[model samples]
Target: MLALLGACAPRPQGLMRPVVAAEATEQGRSVDLLVATNRQVVADPDVRYGNRRDPHLHLTAVSVAMPKGRPEGTVQWPRTTPPQPQTDFHVTRLQTLTTVAQGRGWMRQHRRGGHVLLFVHGYNTTYGEAVYRFAQITADSGVEAAPVLFTWPSSGSLLGYNYDRESTLFSRTALEQTLRLLANDPSINQITILAHSMGSFLAMEALRQMSIRSGPLNPKIQNVILASPDIDIQVFARQFTEIVGPRPRFTIFVAQDDRALLLSRLIAGRVDRVGDINPAEEPYVSGLARAGIVAIDLTRIDDTGGSHHSRFADSPEIVQIIGRRLAEGQQLTTSDIERGGFVMVAAGALHTVGAVVTAPVAVLEAGSRPVPDISGTLAADPDALRTER
Candidate 1:
């Protein structure tokens, strides 16, 4: 029934939504986004977009405009003749960054506090999907920082997992170049990476390469939010340690019930995927805490849209929490953590923090009588934690 409903849902008419400038009298919000992609450019005049690896890197500047009176957390695609005239929700001001110097110049011109939020989409995503997802995330987050999307060539097909993995690996050098350019630019202050699913693998590998070739990561990297990362535990540990210099604060969002990652785990020889690690289990929680990794369990949250896989962007509450923290240039706050019904496993702490709504606030102190597993109990009885909005 759910699959039927999903199949029956309305999809945007066109996958490639170019920008359309709004009229002077129109009341709406516009976000100027910088896009960096390694996808091959498709010459189809009907849909001017990029396809999986044309074996070239392209940089583009786009203006995403939300139509007036449009509901929050929604992007509507306007259907028209040329696809770039007065439309409901449109992206305009598309210009290519022909060279690395040009890309750096554009970044310098638009950077805010040297802060850039770079988003890397996960598996089975096309250039259009990545661009639209980043645009939606930027709009919903309400962050003033410059939004950048690093799109690798994902085969964009469900059965293309092997192809996507290879493509992600193939684009590491290009992604590394993009990151190096941003890091070297004096005008860029900090970069917050939000990588989802397989993209997290690419992001980590690029960082690893940068650290190996260059010295340590540039201090410009402030925070890294790994949303439902589809990575192996052992591989992630190696990448984490290989990163030289001051480590960026890492916040990982995980859900044991994430079906996508469940499939990923099966495909990867049944090894535990980092995103689905059960924090209640020993060694994993302790290891994550000792490594200074902040893990937030979203299994109990009921607000996720579509699937359990994308709660990071799908859930309004989660999105707001992430946006607020990133916008303030800080880690997850006590209030933010608690409000999201999230349990934080801080470094050197054995027990998790935060009280679910409608439940008594309790602290699970280390060495205290077999600490009641907060995430486990909540996962078992999520209804009790849900609060009426």
Candidate 2:
């Protein structure tokens, strides 16, 4: 009878068009819908691993409907707009699930009383990269709010520098608009942003523009973290001076040995912005005249030769600090800021501290080289590696 009734009902239209199939999982969720015209999924719904190696955006219908009675779950609502040829795209249900858990966690926490944590990925990141990074962040940050990722179309190719730059330019306006909307929404209590590499440019540009356009930032924003920002130091100073004015609560995480950024320097005719450190360059943050910037130095640590990338995801200490700050709203001290040791650095003073690297107890011996431990719980696990002693 239920099957006959489902067949008799009018077929749904557009992206939300529904189809019937045996329930996929008794313990899992299921979704069935159409893809907008031009948008595509970069992976096969069945094949999960190779999707990252060479993604194929599939223009098909996908939806996720969670089992009822859960505190928080997914629902496959009909999509409104048709797919456009240019840039609007969507991921498959299988792919999205692999990444949606973090966001759902955020939603659950927000319902209880938590803030939002937004992620912006750097130059060569794919959709999957953004999702996995957020998962790691939510798991590590200890923040309960929703995790939203702003994914610009990055080709994720080392040689696609120009293409990535173009995508950044094209996507800037949209990204800023989204930020503004989130800020103005009264229901939102707090917001924190963690941008990595090239994504730092986008994050800074948005803040600068918003500050210039609007007098001061929404008081709801707490932290503006830049991990391995790829912008020129002097340029950042000048821009912040004009836009933010003084006393901006920003944290810049820098490492002297960022190889990927080193490659970026070569491509830019050997520029210093590729993991170069100059703490004094932007001593004072804009909007706040006082020196409120937090500069963490990853120079002295073993860093596994390419330790710059480990700041956000790998180091247990850093993760613990940020997690405490976001979850508890702890205030840091000036001395602590200078040391950059804990979650709450000293407010009102600039901090320049050296990060402590904890070596793994077990080391693996490779043929010719010692493998660095890279097995931390977060996305970019530096300690999880089976390194040689």
Candidate 3:
């Protein structure tokens, strides 16, 4: 009986474990955890595009340890449950990050050429919503880079509107610190940023602060893409003058038909300001033209929801443009805009006539923005312009 009992005795728990284990599992934490809540529209055309019945809120928690040495922009996605249709469309991740730009410590990593990509999400978004959006943008852009997302508390509750806005404001300082660290990294060559809706304001503020501390702007930045920003035009103009300098390539994707921005304008008590406004309609900061800032207006697309939100991820044309631009490192220009089948509103016609393109124009009515007096302005109606593209 003694011999038999000895044979049945179990080994210690630690002895049974493997010598090497994944960092997350070893720490008794999941490398990736997905929590999906709230029901929002997924816009899966086949699945009742705007059906609220489908779950829209999906959250992802990701914990990663920096690679022991310099990493060549290689990253691993978290292993989680099979993504649902709508849940799969959007990606949000809670990240464990180290601020490499804060001090001499991060300088070591910078010596290894460590770069970072920061993304800030917009309003009416849940943590899950932010993740998928980030993932889509990252993958679609072919940007194999470290991603750090600033996720403010966006209560999935619709009634939490005011709370969410307040929450975003609260998180700006923290986000700025993250950017500061990056700015100090000498080895880091470039920092790419993407901000959508309200996030644009937060990101701009952070950049503004960084510039004040560092002076002018670092040449390491490659691009700052503001998509469907939800800030007031006037405020953005002011912020641009204060923060952004003419170093990195700054591009704004505006859609005059953005209903989401319209809602944002209403909430902010601004009658005419959305992230995606026509540059021609409004005068930007004095240095804007010299800053290499390009604002492309997508008012010609009949985005089914009457919202520009879809352009960033939904529009095949925009995706193609973006993909080509990234793969070839090409900058989109007025010619691409013309070949894209959208007409530019001739600056001369701003007062007497509205811009008309081959496509049917749905949103850029005469009431939208008075045509500027600038010459060589091309205008296209939304319908006729995009029909061929």
Candidate 4:
């Protein structure tokens, strides 16, 4: 487990430096990104933000350029300084917003269709990792919203799991502040949260705080998408229950084959993680269906790098589905998935499995039809079920 986690750690330093040359500007695609983080600032321009906590929120506007014809869901990180943007993901520009008011004003002026997609990254991810990953997703998914990222102080070490988790707790209020600011903004029509792994825990806690303090979440805060959440199942249940009023629509992307969550579960005293649970099983199927949550099982889909935990953004089919359907605050239909065609390890075929009360199914046989009865869920529409208030 240590080796697995350590393998993904970025270089010790210097990947965040801005590349001044515009060689890739003409040929490569560029993505404008808005970053919100609680990471302490450092003097090194080569590595501006370090893994240290900050009491206040820091906002930065960045533009990452990707090489031409880069495939969906892939981030080609620069191998060396003065990155070749044609073959790597390079930061072309970086500007820091001195105040929260300035950040809000920037959003007001630049937001597209009043939509903002906010991403919260998972454990062991560095600042550069989170930035590049969001840029790749924004460029690949073709999501129409303004791309926003909320990064916390992560220790970025294999053995720093405890520190990383605690960092989330420390950074909770900052994130809540960011969320509240966005929620109250009249120009921002909707806020979509896409949190991965342990980041999902942070996102949930932020919403829970908002629910307890501000009454109900603002109606504009629409969808909360969790990708391979590393949250303890019971903790998640309580968090969801405590949020006492109207909340955002929740969609979970789960995979039984997620090795990262499997390791996380082992460290968590064998308690099942929300991400790796069998949604068709007793507690989860009933609880999720009861809560009106949509869980997309990607166990059979596979092929999401070594960890397989980032299947949501690493898989072209899955990412496209998110961009084309889920980003629009729309639920995915069987046909929507059929056109994208998930890359299943078993026979590599198209499958359809949609139910009234959404339940997790591993795969659908080719040419299959929706069978709500056998799916162990009884419902009329996935969007009809409201979260427990």
Q: Pick the candidate with the highest TM-score.
A: 4
**Worst-scoring 10-residue span by lDDT in model 1:** 373-382
Candidate 2 — what's its lDDT? 0.47
TM-score of each: 0.80, 0.58, 0.57, 0.86
How do the residues 147-169 of candidate 4 rate in per-residue lDDT, one tens digit apiece? Answer: 89999999877678899999999
lDDT of 3 by residue, 93-128 (tens): 332222222233333432323545667777656544
State how far residue 68 of model 2 sits from its true place (Å): 25
Q: What C-alpha root-mean-square deviation, in Å, does candidate 4 show against the real structure? A: 10.0
lDDT of 2 by residue, 1-389 (tens): 22321232232113222233343332233222211110124344221222122112122213434333322111122233332112212222432322223333324534325466667778755544444345455555556555556666777565567777666655555455445444544456777777888888777777765565444566767777778877665556554554444334667666666766666666777656623554434332222224345565554443432325555555555565666763344443444445656523222112333221111011112122222332122211112222233
In order, the Cα lDDT scores of the candidates are: 0.68, 0.47, 0.46, 0.76
Clashes of each: 4, 40, 33, 0
Clashes of 3: 33
Give the per-residue lDDT digits (tens) of candidate 1, residues 1-389: 23522442343445454544546545377777888887777776333555467445678887766666666555555555434444456655567777767777788788877788899999977666677678878888876677888988888767788999998888877777667667767778888889999999999888876665544677788788889999988788877776765778788888777888877888899998888876656677566666677777777666435457887887665676677675447876556544533333222122332321111111122221221211111111113222223
Candidate 1 regions with alpha-carbon error over 4 angstroms: 1-13, 17-27, 45-49, 77-88, 338-389
* Model 2: lDDT of residue 42: 35
Model 4 residue 283 lDDT score = 63
Instruction: Compute the lDDT of residue 88 as modeled in candidate 2.
Output: 17
